[model samples]
Target: MAATIDELIALVEQNRDAVVGDLFPVREAAPRLIEASVYHPVICLILQGSKETTSHAGSVRLGRGDMLVVSHDTPVTARITGVPYLALILPIDLERVRTLEQSLTSADAGQAASVLQATVAGSAILETLARLLAIRPKTPEDSVLTPLLLTELHFHLLRSPAGAMLRRLVSPSSHESRIARVAALIRRDYARVHRLADLAREAGMGQSAFHHHFKAVTGTTPLQFQKDIRLSEALRLLEQGAVSVTEAGLSVGYESPAQFSRDFSRRFGRPPRRVLQGIAAE
Candidate 1:
C-alpha cells in the first residue's frame, strides 16, 4: 500500500499540467491557515502529511491513507498541521452517482445524519486513483478510458463503508438528500434573504422537521448556515480590494454595516476594515 501511494504521489508531482478534468492534485510544502472557502462534494485522499478542516459540520483531521468524503457545499476553514502535504481531490459528479446508484444493488444504507465522514481509503480506491493519475492528458487513453475508470472508482466507493455519505446523498427519498438540496440552494443564492418556512417547504418537510434534520446534517441552523455563506463571500470581496467594508456587507445582503462588521469579526476573527487595510498594504 505504501509503495502504491508513493508511486501515485510521484505521478501527481510529475504530471502537474496533465488535464484530467476532475482530478486535482494538491501539494502544499508549508503549513498555513487556508482562508474560508466553499467545499463542494468531493473525495479527498491524503497521500502524505495531515490537515484539519472546520466547517459548520465541525472539525475533522485527516492524514495519510485517510479519505474524507463531503456530501454537500460546506464553507470551511482549513489548516495544514503537517508540512509537505500531498493529496488528490476528486470532485464527485452527482448525476453520475445518481445514475450509478439506481443500478447497484443494496448499496450501504449510509449514516444519513451526517454530511462529512472520514475513514481509511480502501486498497481498491487507492489503486483506482493510481490508474486515473497514470493517464496521460490529451491522449486517447484520457478521453476513452477516463470515464470507464471513474465509473469503476465510483463503483468501488459505493461498495465501501466510507461511501455511505455518497450513497445517502444520491438517495432521493432520504432526509439527508432533501436537506442537501436545500443547502445547495442556500449556497447558490446566499445574497438573498430566505425565509425558514420557504426553505422548509422546498425541502418537502414541515418547518420543525426541516429545521431539526437541517441542523442534524449541517451542524448548524439554517439561518446560521446562510450567515456563514454571507460572511465567507464578504471576506472574499474585502480580500480582493474591489469593495469597501460597507459595500461588501450590503452586497452580501447585510442591511447594516455595523451588523456586518460584528458578524465578519466573529466569523473570521478580524474586522472587515482590518482585512481591507491589510489587502491595501500588500
Candidate 2:
C-alpha cells in the first residue's frame, strides 16, 4: 500500500488555505504539462523527479533531494519538467515566520555570501515538511501531536545548516541584508517612486555595493525587480476595479503611460486594457 497522487490531492483539499492551515503532500506527475500562479512563502521540494520555476529572478531549478524556499510573495511562471516529477510543497504563513524569527537568537549571524540567492536547500527541513504534507487534516485526538510537530520543525530549522547561512537574514546589516530590507520596502510600497541613491543611503552601503548585493540577494537587478513589483501590484489594483490603466501606471511610478503599457504587456502577456477587458467579460 503506497500513497497515491489522488490521496495527496485529497489531503491537500482538506487543508485549505481559507482555514489558515498549511498543507503537506506528495504529488505524482502527468507528462503533458504542469504550471501554477505565483504563490507566497512556498517551500518546494523535489522528493523524486524535478520542477522549474520561472520568475522575474530567473529560473529556479530543483531536483531529487533538492529544495527551494521562497520567503516572500513571488511572481513566477512555473512548470514541472521531465516525467515522474514527484514533489512536495509546504505553504508557510508569514506571521508564523515572523514569530519564529522573533524567538530565535543567533546574534552573531553574518551577511549572506557574495553569491547569495534567495533559494536555499535544507534536506532535514525538507524531509520533515514533506512528511507533514503527506498527511491531511487532523482531529482533536491528534491535537497534541500537531503543535509538538510544528514546534520541532521550527527548532530544527534553527539548528540546521540553513540556519548557518543566515547571519543577517533575520536582521539588517551589511549591503546584502539592507538591500533585502529594501526588497521588503518595495513589496510594501511598489506604487511609490524609489531613488537608487535613497535606497543606497538607507541601506547604509555605497551605491555600487548596494547594486551588487541587491542583485546577489534577489538574482535580479534593482530596476527590474521594482518594475516587476510595480506591474504585479498594478494588476492586483486593476482586478480590484482601478478602472484605468493610466491611473494604475501613474500610481506605480510610471511617468509615461505608453512606456508602462509596453513593459506591462511584456511581463503579463497582454496590455492592461485588453487584459482587464477579458477579465471583466469573464
Candidate 3:
C-alpha cells in the first residue's frame, strides 16, 4: 500500500504544475471528516469507492474512475460515504491552465481541433484519464519530459466520447471560454471591487448574458464567487501568518472589518482572530 501511494505521488508530481501535499494511507468508516475549503482550483479523482462534495449551490459525487473539478474558490463540506473510499486530489494552478490553453491554440490541427472543441464530451476522455492516473510511475523521472503526459491528456480529450465537454474548456470563441477568462481576472485580483457591469463588459457579453453564462460555467452567482475568494484568501493569509485579521480582511476586498469577521466565522466555524491564534499557538 505504501509503495503504491508513493508511486501515485510521483506520477502526480511529474504531471502537476503545482500541488499541495496532504497524503496518507488510511481506512475509515465515516469518522466525521472536517470541512475542506481551498483558495484555488482542485481536481479530485477517485480511484476506489466514492466521495460526495457539497458546495453552497449543490452536491456532486465522484465514483470510481470519476473526477470532480472545483474551479472556484469556496468553502465546501466533504463527507466520505462509501466504505474505505479513497481519492487522488491535485490542485491545478492557473499557470497550468494557461499553458495548456496556449499549446492547444498554437497547434496546427486547424479544423480538427475546432470540431473536437465544439462537440460535447462523452466517456472516452474520462476513461483515458482514469487509466493514466491509475499508474504509479516509480524511479528517476525526467523533469523536462512532462510535455508528453500533458499533450497526451489533450489528445485524449480531443478524441474522447466526452470530448465535447472537455473541449468546451478550450474554445476561445465559446461562452465557457469567456467565463473562464473572467474567472482568471477575479483570481488574479480578488481584492478588486468587482461590479457585475464591469465583469459583463470584460466578458464581452450583455449584463444578463454574463450572469447566465458565468453561472452556467461555475455553478454560482458572481457575488457568491467573490465572497468565496475573499474568504479563501483570508484563510490562507491567516494560515501563513503574514497578516492580522484586520489586514487580511481588508486586503481581500472586505470593506467592513466587522462584516469580514462575521463571514469568516460563519464559513470557517471560527473567527479570524481566533483561527490565527490557534494556528500561531500551534
Q: What number of clashing residue pairs does each candidate have, in the order they appear?
A: 0, 4, 9
Q: 1 or 3, which is superior by lDDT? A: 1
For model 3, the stretches where C-alpha displacement exceeds 4 angstroms are: 1-36, 39-43, 48-50, 70-86, 89-145, 157-164, 280-282
TM-scores, one per candidate: 0.95, 0.66, 0.65
RMSD of each: 1.7, 5.6, 7.4
lDDT of 3 by residue, 149-174 (tens): 44554564434432333345555677
Candidates arranged by lDDT, highest first:
1, 2, 3
> 1-282, model 1: which lDDT tens digit per residue?
523778878888889746585888788889999776888888899989999988877788999988888888888888999978988898888888887876666764734435677888888988888888888888999989999999888888777766776787777978889999999999999998999999999999999999999998888999999999899888888888999988999999999999999999999898889997898788
Question: lDDT of each structure?
Answer: 0.85, 0.61, 0.60
What does the lDDT read for residue 34 in candidate 2? 30
Give one digit per residue, the lDDT tens place, for model 2 in 1-54.
444444433444566331213544455566433322435555565655667776
The true-structure Cα RMSD of candidate 2 reads 5.6
Two-way TM-score contest, 1 vs 2, winner: 1
lDDT of predicted model 1: 0.85
lDDT of prediction 3: 0.60
Query: What TM-score quantifies how close candidate 1 is to the native fold?
Result: 0.95
Residues forming the 10-long window of minimal summed lDDT in candidate 3: 112-121
Best by TM-score: 1
